[model samples]
Target: MIDETDESLNKSSLVFGNFAVLVVFVLLVGGVYLWVSKKNKTGQQVFPAGVNYLSPKGDEAKKPVLLYDFAKLAESSDWVTYKGKIYPFSFQYPKVLTPLTFPNDRSDAVTFKVNELSPEQSLLFTVETISSRDKNLVGKPEEFAKNYWKFFSGLKALNKITKITNEKGMTGYQATYVVKGKNAITSDNYFFVVEGDDEILLHIGDIFPTEGKAVLNRLVNSLEYKK
Candidate 1:
């Protein structure tokens, strides 16, 4: 026979165990409800705000670098492809940069100010298209590139003229000069190609070595001719 005292103890233990489980379940459900109901002063849920605040800042930090990676992988990335209105040649530039076009210039000129880099003088890019008639078709593109600096007064190239061959084997020339009264070195790039009977000269200018010379290099290297 079962002991009477043992039966009483068993009944009491069962009641206490059920009560303990019920208490725990209630606490858990209540905690979830409180968390779900929490909101800001404007009655918007806090969790979404928390996620938005944290997630976007982490992504925002990476954007500037993606824009600044001019040499390594910009053309392959999300940069916008631009075909010159002044000329038929095409190239890619960072999407974050807005293009400023000149309508009245003798040569079709486009300028973009690169804000990602830090320098006292600021990094600026200017490109123009000059016809063979304007420059007077003379020698090869490299020869014209070497002699073209003579037009500018008091500005002499500080570095030796360098020949740059792009991925397509298209050749371009680069020259850097120390401008008077400026602390930075100014870089100039030139690419020559023929379209029909016209010898086309494409010029990109004024990138500081201390600031964004790689960007200038990338831009020059990215050039493509339709003609």
Candidate 2:
């Protein structure tokens, strides 16, 4: 025979068990909502789209070493290459100098101006190919500079015409000369190069001031004859 008291206690136990389960379900739903709301408020993407934020990793990943820093890399060297169209030679210039530009006449000469100079500025570097058309034309360095007022007129030789070997082992002639401009400001240095069929003249002026001697030397030293 079943007791009435026992049956009543069994019914109360069943109701309490169901109520406990309902309370747990409500708490779980509320926790998930709170988590999503917090993430949205913070504007944080815990993981990429379609990725499970709850995924686990065995260990933390190592930070990658950055290989590129444009500003710093630019400091290493601002070299720009220029290939000769008439001759088989190549040279480089720094950011302070402009790239070589051929005039509309496309004569034997190519000119590179100072980056900071105006059109009226007198400071510039030039390379001229001794046109093969003139078999009598000598490939000597001074042949290109004799008529150039800055290289010949009032020229005080700073150093003897010396043999210079570029990085590529192409031997050339180099001589530094002192010349004064119309403004009466004396340029302490002028550099010249004479190779196979080409001659280069670098006229020192306000663009390459007295304080930039080392930089100017480095730029000149980078010249190379591709041939």
Off by over 4 Å in 2: 1-75, 95-102, 105-123, 129-160, 178-207
Q: lDDT for model 1, on a 0 to 1 scale?
A: 0.52
lDDT of each: 0.52, 0.43
lDDT of 2: 0.43
Candidate 1 per-residue C-alpha lDDT over 1-227 given as tens digits, one digit per residue, 9 for 90 to 100: 98999999999999999999999999999998787767432333211000111112232332223334445434446677787675566777767666766556555566564543432223232233344334554436666566554444334444457877676566667655433333433345455444343355566654323235566556666777775
102 in model 1: Cα distance from truth in Å?
0.7
C-alpha RMSD of each candidate structure in angstroms: 21.6, 26.1
Candidate 1 global TM-score: 0.52
Q: List the residue pairs that clash in candidate 1.
A: none
For 81-101, candidate 2 gives per-residue lDDT tens digits of 766565444556555455544
- In terms of lDDT, the poorest run of 10 residues in model 2 is 47-56
